[model samples]
Target: MGERPEGPGQGGAEDGTAWSGRAGAQAFAAVDAATDRLLGYPFVFRELSRRIGAGEVLVDYGCGPGKVADEAARRLGARVLGVDTSPEMLALARGSATAVAEYHLVENGRASGLADGCADAVMCNHVLASLPAEEAVLEVFTEIRRLLRPDAPFVLLSTDPACSGTEYASLRIGDPGEVYGPGDELTVRLRRTDGSWQEARNHAWPVGVLPALLERAGFRDVVQHRPTVEEALTVADAGFATGRAWSAERARPPLVITTALATPAPLT
Candidate 1:
């Protein structure tokens, strides 16, 4: 596939560096995110809608540029909060015409100004790909646990690194038949709205390890779903599902949604 390579730290693995500068933020904002649009986000929203009521709080953890957060607020009528570690991304989000209720900067691995248990649910989409290690992944999950009330759901959306090499409608992960272990580096080529492709260096966290990490982070009832095209037709936005034929996506679904409930507070 024809794609362009972004400059250093544009989408590289570094604290506040991935999607760092104004250029990086804008570039990320322009990502087509076909997998997310077709399968990942729709399933997350549906899971959230079943658990939380309108006006309830939903935190969009790792909300780069706030696109999905804004969409969630509008679609679910929820008070959506967009939180990210990158100030540039937050600045870009604030400048956009978005429905996100609030934007907070993540300082010292904690979301500033958001109270503990403030959200009814939280959805972290594609954020795991940027983490460099399992420890970082655990930290993210632990922070999300802190933001949710007991038993509130935490929904995480990520790509299956094992499905590498296949060119999907919007992105391709690594080379064909390439195998990646946890924390291994991989190249992700993402399509933009302008029909251009750009490459980002991302880490692979195998789907198999997520359940144990969630369990350690004060969560329970962990469940995983690999969304299929047939499922997307029913749950995804009609515009996305019908936009084009998802032949590659239909053959091997690459996205995985892992949901877990925050463990209830201990008895007094």
Candidate 2:
């Protein structure tokens, strides 16, 4: 954690004490509203949902009011759990979600509330970068391994480090850039639904080094897939530039959503 937080902080456009009170609930609801549309949301919920392999349980790590979890449950027919540190965000998630958790995780971004060998898929969309530089990412990976039923797929969506720092900082909140580096203790300034801005320090990590981490975490069948901004829009019923709502909004963002799978290694 000594070095600069890698890359810029990015998120799904949510951040702050969102799970704490009325304000948090409103904040989360706004994020949902943006993604609720066919054009303006972040992440690929439908594609991610369709790809899950007969999942009994799914974990939406850094769930941010649980929109992704709700989408996963609705599409995958899997029992899903959404985890986030904000109470307001949790309430919003609970209202929209049909998952099993009656509560939310208020711990640091790297930790989660679910148990070991529990879920079949873990959707970490726009999540890992919110951790303290590097410490929390590994813990989260370990958590995924422990909660997964072996060879569980970790579907990750994060900002491409190839994207410029200034560009990364431009997203509103819940976007990784806004949540930058967990322990760099870098403060993030975010705008709320009420038209106010708040700041919190976060973590940032690039998309490039993840393969090595997956191998170290005992996940086999680890592979990388880079889908373009155009590809995501076409798949989510959103516009890519001018035609779909999703594509029109996210045409050129550095955001990258990749699907990676890991299986428990066979006994020697």
Which one wins on lDDT? 1
The local distance difference test score of each candidate is 0.81, 0.51
How many clashes show up per model?
0, 46
* Candidate 2 lDDT tens digits, 34-81: 322332223455545565644467776666655556666766777777
TM-score list, all predictions: 0.92, 0.67
Q: Which stretches of candidate 1 lie over 4 Å from their true place?
A: 1-17, 266-268
Model 2's lDDT to the true fold? 0.51
Specify the highest-TM-score model's number.
Answer: 1
- lDDT of each residue in 1-268, candidate 1, tens digit only: 0012222123642232466677777778787777778878888889989899999999988887777888889999999998888788888888873788999988888999999899999988888877788898888888889999999998888888999999999889888989999989888888888997777888888999999988988899999999999989989888869888999999999988899999996122
Model 2 bad stretches (over 4 Å): 1-22, 32-55, 99-113, 165-201, 238-252, 263-268
